[model samples]
Structure formats: structure tokens, C-alpha cells
Target: MDNSQTSILRRTVSSDTYKRLCSLWQQMAERKGQDSILLTEETLFSVNPSLAEKKYRERFCLLFSPEFRALLIGTLRTEDLLYQISIIWDTRTIADFVDRLSEESGQRTEIQCLRDRLQQILIAQPSNNPDLQCHFTLKLLDILTPETLGGLEQMYPRVSICKPVEDALRQQVTQERLLNQVITQIRQSLELPVILETAVKEVRSFLQVDRLVIYQFINESSAENERNHSSQSLGRVTYESRASDRIPSILNLTAEDDCFTYIPRYTEKYRRGLVVAIEDVEKAYSSSFCLVELLRQRDVKAKLIAPIVVEEKLWGLLIAHQCFETRQWFESEKNFLGQIGEHLAVAIYQAQLYAEVQQQKNTFEQRVIERTQELRDTLLAAQSAHQSKNEFLGNMSHELRTPLTSVIGLSGTLLHWSDRGSALSLAKQRQYIQMIQDSGKQLLELINEILDFAQLEAGKVLLNTKEFSLQNLSRQVLKNLQTEATNQQIHLELDCRVEPRHDRFYADPDRLQQILFHLLKNAIKFTPADGTVILRVWKENNYAVFQVEDTGIGISEDQLPLLFEKFQQLEKSRQRTHGGTGLGLALTKQLVELHRGTIEVESTVGKGSLFTVRLPNQSHRQLKTTPASKVEERVTFESKSIVLIERDEEVATLMCELLTAATYQVVWLIDSTTAIGQIELLCPSLAIVDRNIPDVYHISKTLKKLQTTKSIKILLLSDKITSTDWQSLSRKGIDDYLLKPIQPHLLLQRVSALVSSDQNSENDKMKL
Candidate 1:
């Protein structure tokens, strides 16, 4: 292979070159008669002189063919070409050719005589080729040199023995390419199944095994498990590649493996990064009948098992099998298969992480979508309410002015007439006074309605309870509404569907009376002149049911929801027929609720409307306890609510479970971007934020800046914390810090402490 040792064999063989060489040979053969410079049958026979001429002449004649000559020339030495002399001829041919020549005479004289004859043959060629003859003679001398022949023999002592060198070298290159291809797939693909499938098929072909499989565990992988970790009862085959139908698939195969539990060396080796190559399972596992029998059943004569461990858990195994016969596994193959398993474990971990991240992403997206819809609905409601307020503003001005105008005008007219010293009829005076009194009463009623609604909204309203008779209450409400109903020509009826004794139940007499009077008045107002209005009172489930049903200009279903909202009215009629504000039903609902009661309404657009009021018809003593509801009705600080802004599922799950067990209301936010909005919405007692949040500082600062959220307690969680981090955190309005790797009891204690406290000091910090 060095410059001095290698011959400069310049191959000038082309179509044209072949033609010239063929013509030269033809001329030589014509002159020499069956003998030429090129190889001939007789020349080969001389080298193997002992051969039976008739029998081997045909075989020897093959060397003179163009195909053989081309193959021989292809083996010649060159810088770039591989010296593959073994492909055409081995040492036996060379030894025989050299040995036959030496048998005739002295070796030197024989070689010299042959070289001179070849030189004379080239020199005697009749052609205008002076330079060629000299160059040819020099190459002829070099070829006949003893040292060059010795060098060739030494460099390639025996071609037959070294034939596998080329194959082994090619195998190395192929193996490298195969491994790179598998790694590339892992890198490029997010689809775990596709990567695993392609890897197994390619690996099986590379290892030239009957089958390859990824034996993944159905049960969670653990190094501690003796029964499940064993080969005989190992995990299920998740992916497999088979050489042919002749090879049996071990997919879903299960066998009893009690012996594996007793002898755990196999699994132990796998954990230590060692491949368990079973050359002959039948022989090696003869002691374990279960393992041997299982292998036999699966047509496994040989096997290579490598563990796919991820994050120190024995996730599964990469297994290869030889089904036909027992195999002698090479060390290199064992190492490569183990390496594949390691790489596959990496892929599995990556894929699992990708799946988790995607799940988190999808969950966040869904939450965002749902929250967006909720916000949109809220915004619409707020806009609607704002529009109603504007309408009320205009309506209130008109409503107040009419009564004031009447009152002022009547009084002013009376005073003017008196001051003018004019005597008018007493009838006119009484009518003017009456008109002023009526207008004053109307203005007072509107002011009282607004004042009551304001008091209810401020949570200042308290019920003055009494056992009022439902019968009397119904009669009074009907009587109060009789004149109004009569003016509209609408019939008024009272249906008290209760025993007189049972009707005397617990309630505020005045508020209860007000509740009924409002319902009946509303019914009478909306009714057409000939329509009917009824006040129906009954007792059911120890509760009073006061239903005011009317055959009136009914309310549409869409407006029914708005009917109980403040400043809401049946606008279709507010401008034309009905008067006053939109607070009647809203105020009634509030008062009903204050007395531990409910109000429900059912209405048809064109037929009628029914408003049902249910109040607990019990005495004051009855409110001390209730039998059906086991839970207490009183509010306490234990009702403390928290907003958790942590994205890690494992950590969140632990924290949420603990807090919930401790009876705290927890709202989890996987999407950190919504942290501030959620805090503002819920206005929770505490917001537990993970420091991992990129905008944790900004979130806390934002919460502190908002008036509604300023008082909220903030608990910052981190995996690690130094003294230096606290200053920044404290400046950002982080009231407290708790380090992560969350401890259940400690996490609950910290959360409870934060939620219970009305405020947090900057120095309050807890570590792992």
C-alpha cells in the first residue's frame, strides 16, 4: 500500500483501446500460429502440466475469454481501486503456476528465459512504436523481479482466508448507516408508533434476525416487581417485525413465570445496562421449565433482550429472536442492540413529554374557548343592563315630572286664585286639593320603590317575621287590587287552597303582604279590560305557595329572564300602556329571597302569565335546624376560596387534592395567561401561583394594582429559592413563598394559613 511497494497500474482500456489491442493480438497470432503475447490455452496448460489435457483443456480455455481478462484487469493495482485479486484467483493458482515453472530448471534461469522471450515478442512486433518497446521492456523486467512477487505474496498471503474482510467492512458501514437512519427517524418524527415500526423492521433486517419486537408493559414498569419483571411473564409485545410467516409471533403471549421471581439475574443485568443474549434458550434455561417452554412455543431458538429504561423505570425491552436455529451472538451485535434500546427509551421519553405538552396545550385552548364564551355572554348581559339603565334614566325623568307637574300646578293655581281675591266654587277647591294629594302620593310611591331596591342590593334588608294568616293576606291583596281590576273590567278572585289552621305560618306580615300586593297589582296592570286575575294561596311541603295567575297581555319567554333583573321591564308596553319603573318584580324577588323563599314564573306570549312564590311557612324556632339538608346553612371562614396558577399536572393534582380534602374551594388555572382575569373575577382570598410562570411577577403586580384584587393574598411556589430571589418577588407583590416538590400536609397548612389570614407580611416564607 506504500508508494515504493505499489505498482502504477494505469488501465487504458476503452472501446477504442480494446479494438487496437485486439487487432495487435490478431496480427501476432497470425504470425506466430496459435501462440501470442496474450494468454492462450497451451500457456495455461504449461502452468498446470500434470493436468489430463483432454479433461481440463475446456476449463483452462476459460481464462483466455474476454470476460475473464476484463475481470483480471479489474483486479490490478491502482490508488483508488480495491485490490480484489481473491475475487478472480486465489493463492493456489499462483503457487501452482510458480511451482510448475520452477520444476523445469533453476528458478532464476527459468524466470530470466521467460522474461527474455516476452521481451523479444514485444520488441519484434513490426510497428512504428519505439517508445512503447522500451517502456514495455522496463515493465516486463519489473514484473519478473523476485522482490515484487514476494511483496504481493506478503501483502495478500492467502486471498481465500481474507475473503470475508470485504464483507465485514461493508457490514460495518451498513450498520453505521442503519443506526444513523434510526436516530434520524427519532429526531424527525413525533409519531411514536411510526418511528418504532420503522425502527423494528430496519433493525430486524440489519441483525438478520427472524423477528424483532418491543415488549412494552401493560402494568406500569418497576424495578421492584419480581413477578412482572421476569422474562416468562414479561410485558406484552407492543410492536413486532417478522422475517416471514414461518416465524411465530409472540405478540400477546403469556406464560407462567414463578421461577423468574426466584432468579432475577436476567432483569438485574438489564438494569445495569447489560444485554442478555440467549444463544440457546433451550440449553441455557433448561433449569427453568417455564422460560424454556415459553421460548419453544414462540419458536425462539435464540434471543437478544435489551431493556428500554426511561427515567430509571424499566419501561420495556427491545427483543430480537432467531426462530430457525440457535445462534452465536457477537459482542458487537449485543452492544448495538443494547444501544438501540437506549435510543428507543429516549424516543419514548420524548414522545411522552410531547404528548403531555400537547394535552396541556389542548386543555388550555379548551379552557380559553369556554372562558371566552362566558366572557362574551357576560359582556352582552352588561351591555343590555346598561341600555336598560339609560332607558330607566329617561323614564324616571318623565315619571317624576308628571307627578310634580300636577302637584305644583294644582297648588300654584289654588294659591293664585286665593291671592287674586277671587271667590271660586268649593267643588273646584276640593277637586284641586284632591288632585294635588293624588300626585304627591304617586311621587312618594316611586321614591319608596327605588329606596327599597337600593336597600336590598346593599344587603341591609332584614325580615320582621310574624305568623300572618295566608287567608287574610290573600283577601287584603285582592281587596287592594279590586278597584284597579274593576276599572279595567278584569275579574278578581282569591283561591286559598289551604286549611285555615295551616295558613297561619311564619313570615314577615308587612313584607308578605307587600309580596302579594305587588304580584296582584302587576297582574291587574297587564290584563286587558275583560281578562281575569286570581290570587291563589296554598301550602305544600311545609312551605307557603302563593301563585298569582292571570289571563292578561302575557310576557314572552325571552323577557321572563329579564323580568326579575333590576331596571328591567316589558319595554313593548312600558311606552304605551304600563307606567312607573322596571323594579316591581326585581324588588319582589329580593324580598322573597330575604325570607328564605323562591319565586318562579311561567308565561305565554299571548295567553296568560303565572307567578309562583314559595316561602318557608315555619315559625322562627323552625329556622334553627332543617332535617332534609344535612349540611349547616351558616357561612364560615372554612369557605375560603383559592385560585391555583400552576401548569404542572402532577404538582397541581397533588395540591388540588389536598386543598379539596381540607374543604377549600380551589380554581385551577392550567393557562397562566388567564391568571389575572380569574383573580379579578373570583376575587379569591388567595392566589397560589407557581414561580415557573414566565409572568409571575407581572401577574402579582397587576393584582396588587387593581382595587378589587389588591387585598387578595398571594402565595408564590418555586422548586428552589435563594435569599436573592425573595427581594425581587417581594417587590412584585408576592406576599409569601413556598418551595415546591410539594409536601401534602405542608402544602395544605400553607394554603390554609394564607387563605385564613386577611393579609400577609412580606417576610412570611416557607421552604421545602
Candidate 2:
């Protein structure tokens, strides 16, 4: 091409437009035989020299230059002709060269580019689209002249049919452009509101409708659970675009809106791609008065609807209304709306997926934060425990060495005096010996504390529970701590509020003594000179409460939580003043919990501290049982045979031996579970039940209820039973309620009398 051709092209169109087109043509022409095409050298150069040199491409980039737009139609042209064309080729142009130079190259691909953060929002690469396999149809009308359009004057003639071609091209281009804009919006933003709003406005303008809207249905689960439709709001107009204010806006109309109560019952059909088109509302809904009234009120004469189905569910509807005059429905228009609906579905699915991903990201971040904080807390606790144990190690070194030094130093002095043959005065020698004994005891106590803490931590300690008097134990504890309290110049007081009846609570007597001793010793040790340390004991129902209150330097509030932690000593400055192993309070708490009891403390910084311990009565677990012990193989006298339900080992053994020595079969049982079975097997005529058995009352009642044992006489023994209570005791199936201190001879006499009474009653029955 020469300057003349370029000049002619410039005169036909803008200089920038023709120059860019020429550049693209030259580039495509240079890639010869690289990709299959429907163009040949002879055919391209024969009809029009300019077009002959241009290679064909189905897709082309259309860029608007400022100079070009100013020369041609500028920004003021709002008609369809001014709209940009995305693809200038159609199917008609492909067939013209199908026989000449066509190949089976139908697969084409384009990668969708997006922002980094939104890269995962794509469904897939949109390659292999059937729309890309067409030929070029709309030629450059700008470059076409009357002489050139004739195409060398022989094969084609008068090719300048500009207006008809331009209109057809414009229409197709506008529809494609609208769809491209929707796709662009979907890619650019994740906000559903913005996408839908932009889509509705653009669609309404393109289709020339009075109203366009997106009606979103409420969640199906929520709608089904709701009883009030007014509050439920089944479906509402979420997005709307209107041409004029005269046509009433149904932008937010729901099922509760006036005349909007009717819901279209075509969901199933719509989900399967059904498009609804009503040419005229009155004619379509002739018998439906409510729908007609609704349409009339909105000034809507025609309506077209397409369903936006997402993941095979009818998510919402895309609706367009004609309000001015009655309109005819066209197949092309219906299909276009349906295509738009499909695109909207894709956008909806993408937006929902993006939202879900973002939520998951947020949840994962929150969990990370929580887990990080937990790890930090665990680290701090471990460090504090390590530090506390370290402090304990240092204190223990001092504690262990002091008693050891006293033992070594005092014994050395005693040996020196003895070797020198210079015996000291008896008083002086006794004083030295007493101090050595005291130091040894102190060392032993420290060793025992460490051993006890180790055993408790290892879960090796077991309770040896028995009945003990609380008052006796408290007196012993006070006596042990009395000397220490006097030495410290502290006043010690004991207030026992336990009633005589409840004073004998059940626990291990030795451990109970140890617990009270340690508590009182602690009180006396911590009390300042002339301070008062009081020990209070009381019974509250089944629990016995022990409180130790001291008017001494009390604990601070901040130190209370860790006061019972192992090897933790408080007020480090006073640690040297009040010297001992740090395991005292920790050991106390462990012992309390070991008995299924709780210990609590209340204190003020400089005022006083009260330590309260509540211990539950465990009398039922006090006894050690010997189930079915020493059952004889044979019975000589059926009436003389007896079953002994006793908990005390010595008492049961003595009773069993005595009855056997009298030539009577005997079964001794401590566990009540096996008492009835053994008695029935032995056919015992008498059952001696002890009050120490937990279910002794129930045992007697059950034995009397049985037919074989109903005639058997029960002998009840209890320490507290009196002669006056026999009437009340006999009514409970006991033929005799004997008081305890049962001598061998006395037990035998009562047994003989009770057996005779039963025998006499049986004899009376036989005679009757």
C-alpha cells in the first residue's frame, strides 16, 4: 500500500482508527501459516487491495482513541451505532471460505485476568466457548467506498449497504456489550448488591422497559418454619430500575405488600429454565382478579420473567415490566432475558463461594489467636511453677541442715566430755540431751512431711477410717501445740460445739490427730507474741466443721490462689522468721480433699486469717467387712443353727466360735449383700445382727418378710440400746433388743431364751 491508499483510508475514517487497524493487519499477516486461517493470497488481494492484505481474526480488540472519537461520533452519540463492538464476525462469513481454506481448528482459549486477592473466585477458564468459532461478518464501514465496495467491478456489485448492516450489527453488539458489562461487574466486585444493581439498571435500559427488578426469595428453611407470612417476608424486590416515577415502584414489595400477596407457583418449571412472558396482564390473568388489580395498580401492561437458578435451586427471579402500552412477546427477547438470568446465576454462585471462603479465613484467624493465647498462659504457669519449686529447694537445704548441724554439734560435745572423764552436772547434761532429742524429732518431722507429700502426689495414700471422738482428738491436738504456743507467748483457745451424740464422727483416728496437730501448730507458729489463736469445732448436719482463726499477720488476697500449691511459701521476707518446710498448707489441702472434704481460707492483709475445713461423715465406710466367713458344712439342730450379721471382726469371730462350741451350725457375715443367701442355705433359726452394719435396719426387715425366715428370732445388739426402748425395737421385727457388753454367758442365755420363744410360737401354730 502507498501514500495514496493511506490517504484514501484517512479520508474515509479517522487517521488514528485506520492506522491502528493497519498495524494489527500487518501483525496478523506476518504470522503466516502459524495458525490455520480461511484466507489465501489471491482471494485476499483480488477484490479489494486493502482488505486483501488483511488477515482474518474472529476476535479483535476495539480501542477508542480521543482523536478518533472526536473525528467520528464523539461522547454525545448515545445511540446503538455508537456502542462498541466486541466481536465483528458472525457465521455467514465463515461459510464463504469453508470450502477454500478451512481446517478443524474450533478450540480457542482466553485466560481471565483478575486481582491477586480475587484470583480464587473464578469458576474456571472460559475457553472452548462455542461463541468464539464464528467468522467475521460486520466489515469496517469506515474504510468502504463506492468504488471499492464494488469489489473489482465483476464478482460483486454495489456493496455499500451501510444503514441496514450497521443497525443489525449495532443490535447484536449492544446485547453482547450488556452481558460483558455484567461479567465485568461480577469479576470486579464481590458485593452482590452492587452487581445486581448495576445489572438491573443496564438491562432495563437495553430492553427499554419501564421497570426491572430482582426478586429474591427468602430461605426455604426459614420460610417453612415461619407461621406469619407478614413477618416472614417470603420474597422481596431487592434491586430495581425504573424509567419513570409515574409507574409505581415495587422496589421493596414482599408477600405482605399490598396486592403483592400472590406468589407465582412455577418454581419447579423456572428451575428448569422456563421463561414467563405475559403480552397483556388483563388478557393473561382474565379470571385472576387479584393479579390483574396488582398489575393495574402498578400501571404494568406486560411482564417478562426469567428465573435465576443457582446450584439447581431457584434463588430468585429477573423480571421486566412494560408499563406504557400493551407489548408483544418475542422469542429473541425471552431468550436474551434467560441468558441474562444464567449469567446472574454464575455471579450469584461466585459471590456466595467468595463469602464462605472469607468467613472460613476469619474463623481460622480467630482460632489461631485463641490458641496462641492459650500457649502463652501455659508457658507462664510452667515458669511460675518452676520458680516456686526452685525456691522450695533452697528453703529445704536450710531446713535439712539446721537439725543435722544440731545433732552433729551436740553429740560431738557429749563425746568430748565423756572422753575427758569430766562428766557435767546432771541438769546440764540432761538439758543438752533434751535439745538433741528435740532436734532429732524436728528433723524426722521434716522428712515425714516430704514423704507424705510424695505419697499423696503419687496417689498411694489410702484412708483407714474408724469411729473416733472429736473432742478427745481436739484435746490431744491442743496439748501438743500448748508448749509451742506458750513459748511463742500466744494465747491458745478451743471451743468445741459438737453435741455429745455427734462428737464420735467417723475418720482415721491417727490421721485426724495429725490434721489437727498440724493446723494448731501452724496457728501457733504464725501468731505474733501476745496474739490469740482460737480453734473452733462444730457439727452441721452430717459434716463436722473445723475452723482455725488467728489474730496474726494474715495472708494477702493476691497470694490466696497459690497458697495451697506445692512448695509455695508466701511473704518471702518473713520466710526466715517463721522457718519450716513449705509443704504444710499444701499437705493440709491434699489431706482434706483425700477424704472428699473441702478447705477454704479468708484473710485480710494485716488483720487476721481464718482457715475452715469441712469433713463429711463417712461412718458407713468405717467398717472392714468379712463376707460369709467360717460357714459350717453341716447343721445338726435346725433350730439351733444361726446366721451372724456383724461388722466387728473380733465380735463376729467370738460369736461364731461360741455357737459352734455349743454344737450349732454357724455362718458369720459382715457384708449385708450375702447375709440372706447364707441364712437361707443354712436354714438358721436365729440371726444375730450388729448395729455397726450400715443396713442393719433393712436387714432385719427383709429377713422377717421371707416365709422361711419369718419364724426366725432376730437378736439386735447396740451400745446405746436401753431397757425402755425394747417396745419400740420389738415392733421393728426384733424379738429382743439386748444392750452391748455382751458376755459369752450372757449372749448364750439370751440366744437360748429367744430360740425357745420362737419354738413355743411355732408349736402353738402347729397345735392350731
Candidate 3:
């Protein structure tokens, strides 16, 4: 052979038996044709006795059977013959071969050198290529570590270590180590499922087994001795071996139906417990049907089942099975599975606690919403009730005032008409007129109280601000009460720190006077016959103070708090004796407040009481004298078309007569209903209304609605008409308001002012 050809032959057959076979084949090929030369097992065995047993078995099968020879030759050319041969050989034969290689003095040094080279190649290769590293790693383990040999014997009893098998084993172990790290990280970082899953994958790869499952126990009923167990099964994983391209089946199992049998023992243990079963498919107990069925289908030979426990409760179980091969599980492996399961239990418990807290928060929020709605409803109801009370009071006041207006109006007419000589003697006529006047005054006072009370309730009481003399105001009040005091034989005294005429201040003069009048009148009404009333006025610290003291029946201590309440009579049975509405003091207090003043009362039982009124005083200009001509002109006679609407015929006639004497074209309507039509037809220059008419507001609204009565002046006459009522009537389009028992001169003045003002306003409108 040429040197180049010899070198090629030497490389192809470096081993002893291979070299002899190659030489024989070369000679045969040269003698005969290349086709005639055959590479046979006998030729290999003849040169190397070490290969004799393998060659004997191979040659016997190949020579006797043509099919076997063809198949062997075909497999050798296309596949790895060394690897295939190792796989087919028994584990004992391979182990013996490894042992012999270690003992032989001639090959020991060569083997050692090869082993070093293999390690260098493995270390040089990238870690990403697990198969290459695995091959070298297994080869080195076989050469250097007898412990590994023993372990492999126990782990894979029937298998032999060949190049490809060694590659797969190395890859699996490396993957298992990586997966174990991942499991540890998951346990440290996350909590349960992630750690369990990672651990299961690692174990599955290391053992070369399929069907790793995790089943969790759900306690359906938490009640003691009544706990029902349920299972949540995490399904299976499949494993593909390097020797076979086909994937083997892996199935998961859960003990949901037979939970009592499988879970009771684990619950009692309060720690990890394990079950290892071979041929679990044939087992009759119904611990886990899924596990059994899967094992049977995949031809599984062994399984390891471990419980997951947390805080003395059996949370779940992890099942790993070997499908294509039989495996013996170790104590360390079982313990690892239990630890992973424990992590899973803790995660589930935390999630449950979070859910419970969220539920309670939602419930509390719903209750708060309901309570808020209830409070809103109650507040609305209270507002509605208050509104109803105001309306009722307003209606009652209107009804009461109508009749009182007529009584006072007629009395005023009678007093005016009385002469020195009459149907009766002068003395008797004067006495009768005085009685009528007294009754009319009493009625008017009661009506005024009612009207004042109504105004306070409606929050419509307004003060008329003006500069007036406080001393003159007090004097005027005393002058008005002089006649009453004289008849009662009681001395009424006025005490002022400043001069009666010199004490000038700025305020609502009329409202202040009205409050003083009510207080004095209340003192007079409650005083006994011949009892004295004293009016005291003074100024202190920018405020004017007035005190009205009287010798009268005093208020009880218990009644003091309720003294200013509307319609509250101090002595219920004594109401008629006083001939006064209980609203006088109440109205007095409210009017004082309207003027930004305060009223206080101090009294003792069976002793006289004193009332004090303090008002903030502002400086006032000196009163200007009215011209004589202006005063006379204001009272001058004027002819006006006047309509008087009153409920009583006697009062209506008296009003008509008075207007007639004043040269007014008078139209009197006794019934208020007919007044609207009469006024509309007459189109009067002025209309006089008794506000005590039934449906008074409706009547007022109707009068306002009259189109024909444009620029027509209205004068509302009421025994109850005070400054507050006057303001309200003015807002309703009444030009002026007059109280019952009206003075002739004062009435004349208002009528003239209203008529002239109306004429001026109309002229302005025409110009516009």
C-alpha cells in the first residue's frame, strides 16, 4: 500500500481488533474484487481475544441469518455502532469492561490521558450545549468516580452507559441543578405554586420520569369535625428520552373522591408524608384514580407521592411517576418535594385572608351610605313641618283680624259722632262713647299682637330706620296712655336722665315706639286698679335704655323662660280679666331685636315686674318744623272716589259716612266678595280695604290683578296693622296702611299724600 493509503488505514483502525479486520479486508480486496471482500465479526475476534465474546454473539446471529447481517451492516454505516452496541449490551458487561480498563497496566496511562483531554473539551464548550458537556461529564465520571457508578446502578439498574446515554444523563443532571436553583429563588422571592412547579420540573428531569403533578386540598367546610376536603389537580408533564424520538405519556393524579383516605394521615402528621408505590396501576384503593389511569396508560412502574403541610394543615400533595422506566426514590428526594409543597400552602392562605378583608370593607361602606340617606330624609321632613306651621299661623291671623277691624272701625265712628247733646243726655252719651272706645282699643291691641306674631313667624318683620327723639317718643307713648291711667286712678310717671325733649337718637322711631307702647300697655293691663306704672329712660355706653316698671301681678320663675313665646298666656284663666292677647310681650321682644336692641324682664311672684329695653343709639339731626301751609294743605278737603270693603254693615256704613263728610265719592261694600266688582266698576280714585276679610291675601292678589284700577291707590285698614304689616302691604302694592280706630287728622294726611303721590307717578308713566 502507498504511504498515504497506509496512513488512512492506520487512522480508521487504531484499535487492535479493528486494525486486524482492516488488514484482512485489504488483502481480500486485493486478491478478489472489492465486492468479494467482507468485513465480518469472525475476522475481528480472530485478532483480539478481548472482543471474542461480542464478536461470537454478533457473528452467530449475522452468518446464520442474512436479514440480521444486512440490518447490522446497514445500521453500522448510518448510525453510531459503538453507542448502539453499548445500549444493547447488559449493564453488568459494560461495568466489567470499565473495571478491566481501570485495572490493565498497559492501557491505564492512555485512559488517564484520554480522560484529561475529555475534561478539557467539556470545560471549553459553552454551557448552552448541555448534550456535549453531559457526554464528557459521564465519561469522566465512569473513569474517575466509583461512587457515581454505584449511584447509577441504583438509579438505572437495567441500563448501560454509552456515549449518547451519558450525554443525556449529564444534560438532565445539569438541568436539575439549574431547576433546583430556580425553585430556591422562587421560594425566596414568590411563595408557593412557583416554587412547587420549579422543584417538580427539576426532580422530573433528574429521575428521567414523566407526569409530575401537584394536588391542593380545599377545605369545603371549616367547621370542626366537619371539614370536607376537595382537590385542585395540577396536570401532567411528558418526558422524551434521547434513545427514542417518540414522546411518552405523563398523567397527573388527585385524591378528590377518596380525599378522606389520603388526606387524614397527612393532616395528622402536621409534616411531610410520602407514599411510594410500584405498579400503582394495579392497586385497588381509590386514593387517586387519575394517577392510576395515567400510570396504566403510560406503563408506569413507580411513583413518589408527598404531602404539603402548613401550620398543621395538609394543604396538598405532589405526585411524580416513572412511566418508561422503574425508579427507586430516596429519602432526600422525598423531603425536597415536601418542602416545596409547604411554600405553596402559605401563598394560598395569604390570598384567602386578603379576600376576606376586602369583603368586610365593602360591607362597611354600604352601611355608611344607607345611614347618610336616612339623616338627609329626616332633615327634609323637619323643614317641611316648619313651613306648614308658618302657613297655618298666617291663615289664622287673617281670619281673626277681619271681624276685629269692623268692631274698631264702628267704634271710632261712634266716638267721632258723639256731641254735647244727643239721643241720650251728654253725660250718658259721653260714658257710652267712652265704653265703645275702650272696647275698640282693647280689640285693636289684640289684633295688633296677632299681626306682629304672624310677621315674626314669617321672618318678614322690617324696621323703619329714621332719626327721631327717644325722649319725645317716650312722651308720646305716655300721652297716649294718659286717659287709661287717669280712669284707673294710677299715676303714670316718666323719668328721663336726659331732658324729655333733648334726648334725640337715630333708630326705627315707629318700631321703637310700638315696642314701648306694648310694654306699657302690658304693664297697664296686668296692674290692679289704682296701680302705678313708671317709665324710665337713660343712655349708657352708646346705647339708650328704657325701663317700664309697674305694680302688677308678677310672673312665676318657671314661666320666665316661656314669657316671649307667641300665644303663651301666663295666666290662662286671667286672659279675659286682662283683655289682651298673649302675643304683646312676644311681639315686643321681636321688634326690639329688629332694631338691634335687647329686652329683659325681671319679676318676683306677688310683686311688680320691671322690663328693660336697650337700643344702640346713633346721632340724629334736629327735628325740622313743618310749614303751616304744608300741614294745612295736607289736611285740606279733597273729593275722591273711595270704596270701603268691610265685613260688618255697621262699620261699612260708618266708613261711608265719614268719607262722604270729607267730600269723597264713597262706595261701601259690606261683603268683601262684592268689593272686587264694585271697585272695578267704580274705578275709584282710592280704595279702603279691611285686611281681616276672609281670604285676605287672595283679595289683595285680586285687587292687584285689576287692569281697570291702574294707578288706583289702596289704603288697607286693620286693627292689626302695625309697622311690620304696613311694610308687607306696601310690597303687595298697597299705597298706605291705617290702623283701626284711626284718627281723623292722621287719616286725612295719608289720603292726601297717597293721592298726590299716585298723580305724580302716573304723570311720570305718561311721560315715559
Best by lDDT: 1
Q: Mind giving the per-residue lDDT tens digits that candidate 3 earns over 342-432?
A: 4455655664565678777886797688788888988886775575446435544554465466556656555666643344556765776
| lDDT (tens digit, per residue) of candidate 1 on 1-768 | 232111122222223333333344344334445443344335545555554344441211112111111112223234422233221222223224434444542444544554455334334541212232233323333332345445545655542233244344345456656777777888888899998999899999999999999888664344545634544455578899999988877777644446465565556666767788888998888888877877787888999988888887778888999998999987668867887888888899999999999999998998899899999999998998899889888788988999999999989999998998995689999999988998998899899999999988876666655667788878887887787788889999988898966767787888888888788888888888789998888888668898899998888877777888888777743455678788888899988877657899999977899999988654454334323221122111122678899888878878888888887778899887887876776667889999888998899999999976787889999976768888878998998888767877778777778766753431142111
Best by TM-score: 1
Off by over 4 Å in 1: 1-160, 163-169, 218-236, 248-274, 279-297, 324-328, 357-382, 420-434, 464-468, 507-509, 572-575, 595-597, 616-768
Question: Candidate 2, clashing residue pairs?
Answer: 44-52, 89-136
Q: Which stretch of 10 consecutive residues in model 3 shows the poorest summed lDDT?
A: 62-71
Ranked by TM-score, top first:
1, 2, 3
lDDT for residue 38 in candidate 2, whole number 0-100: 25
Which stretches of model 3 miss by more than 4 angstroms? 1-423, 449-462, 489-491, 499-502, 529-532, 573-576, 618-768
Q: After superposition, how far is residue 478 of candidate 1 from its true place, in Å?
A: 3.2
By summed lDDT, which 10 consecutive residues of candidate 2 come out lowest?
A: 63-72
lDDT for each residue of candidate 2 in 284-306, tens digit (9 for 90 to 100): 88876876886788788999999
Better lDDT candidate (1, 3): 1
Q: What does candidate 3 score on TM?
A: 0.31
